[model samples]
Target: MKDKLFKNLLHNAKGYSVLNSGGQLVKGYKPDTVLQKGNEYIIMECDTGTSRKGYLGAMLKAARFLSNEKKGVLVLVIKEKPNTKVKQIAEHLQEYLIWLQPLTNLNIVYLIESNRYCPDENPLELLSSEFITTATIIKSD
Candidate 1:
């Protein structure tokens, strides 16, 4: 039930699919959910686990390359909503973001849990918001 619901909500996002050297789409990477809005392209890796340093860096690197050529936002959406887990990921993602901002046109947004549209002033400022206000504002305009 949870997976089905998530898929439905997530399916609305569509963007250019990234192709590899072999002319195949990458395995773990998902296409940007929202199109280029103000030169901001959001790429979200909807993970269902706690993020690790290695995994974050690897994902960041991939996003960096894509964002450079495309010029957009790179978001890492995690499913771990527990307080401690969220804190840990926020810290790591921030650290990774510092290094990545200079190299690529990437922006990060994390959505922990969602059964419905989240209400918040700005999820970018408030990481725990139910919906991505950044996406909302970009699309509305």
Candidate 2:
């Protein structure tokens, strides 16, 4: 599953150069993969674990990456739909961010992988109240 997800992301990133792969540490965060196209950075973190910790950790990493990078997109790839616990965590994180009011622009993408063979279909935009206010969902084929 991990391999398929990684492959799908690579396929989607056609012209991007792979900056990091196989969980190499970068600025204290070890994302599954990182790609760069021109001046835009795309940071990807895949979550296949069956626990709340995994989702929370991924969200935390997204926050960290968005906070640090001036121009980048953080994609959180998941094998299945997030559960209630995960949603609750997102809400809490959203509240924290609202209070802190960081100036950086947050472009977080949630990719739900449904098909390993084709992972670039059924694109959807997430509502502001669903998870993070600026988060979007991109369902895989």
Candidate 3:
């Protein structure tokens, strides 16, 4: 089920791979899926229906692991659109992450709504150059 979600969400990606225990050991951390485009790598964490706390905690943990990384994106993929309170929490997490960038050296973090894509939406747009401006996932209605 999760695999299908990742495949559909990342279908437009040039290439990607699912990480196993060995892969995680190699990378020092495991993301549900990993997408590579050119020199960039996107490590994604997917959650079915975990609490907002769990979601943000996992994202923070990933950032800590990637503290020395100078590139790449940490993407948090959730199965549904966040509720009002969760959205607020995400906003707070965004602020905290931005502030911690200098210390962690983690570049970007994207919070994506897995089921919100339309045919007209380009998944790659989420990782476009302009993303450098906001560094936050902008899910469409």
Candidate 4:
């Protein structure tokens, strides 16, 4: 899933160029993927539903990066809806970093697979299609 997302962002997504990726270190942090569109940058990380500690670290790193750069958006992609605790943590972080809210944004993308009647739906389609759509909206805003 992470691979697909990276590929989509690096190749399929228009107007975006890959800056750092594949766990490459950037300013002492290794974001899963970083993209640039003009002067704006985006830092992305994928949560594999493994550890909350790791997720928290990613959020903190994003906050730090934004605080320093004063631009870009942090995108955290998850396989399902975040639990209550995760939501609370995110809210608190946002409140604490309210000053950076205008210059940067934290966007969460839930990649929940549809279980509806569509038999031909490819599960990876969401990563390829919805991700770019979401990113485009975020960038536009």
Query: For every model shown, what is its TM-score relative to the native structure?
Result: 0.51, 0.57, 0.60, 0.54
| Residue-by-residue lDDT tens digits, candidate 3, 67-102 | 553346676655554452335546756766776666
State each model's C-alpha RMSD to the native: 7.8, 7.1, 5.7, 6.3
Provide backbone clash counts, one per model. 4, 0, 0, 0
In candidate 3, which residue ranges exceed 4 Å CA deviation? 1-28, 37-39, 81-86, 117-141
Q: What TM value does model 2 have?
A: 0.57
Q: What is candidate 4's lDDT per residue for 22-42, written digit by digit as tens?
A: 565455788877777765566
Write model 2 residue lDDT over 50-138, tens digit each, in one string. 56566556655655665544456556555554453334434444543444236444444444342432334532222224233334342
Superposition TM-score, candidate 4 onto the true structure: 0.54
Off by over 4 Å in 4: 2-13, 68-70, 81-93, 99-141
**Per-residue lDDT over 48-130 for candidate 1, one digit per residue giving the tens place of the 0 to 100 score:** 55447644764565455555457554444455456435447665566666666666655554434322232332223222243
The full ranking of all candidates by TM-score, starting with the best, is 3, 2, 4, 1
Per-residue lDDT, model 2, residue 115, is 43
For the record, the alpha-carbon RMSD of candidate 2 to the native fold, in angstroms, is: 7.1
Question: Of the pair 1 and 2, which is ahead by lDDT?
Answer: 2
10 residues in a row with least lDDT, candidate 1: 132-141
Model 1 score (lDDT): 0.43
Q: State each model's CA lDDT, in order.
A: 0.43, 0.51, 0.54, 0.50
The residue pairs that clash in candidate 3, if any, are: none
User: Which candidate achieves the best lDDT against the true structure?
Assistant: 3
Q: What is the lDDT of residue 76 in candidate 4?
A: 56
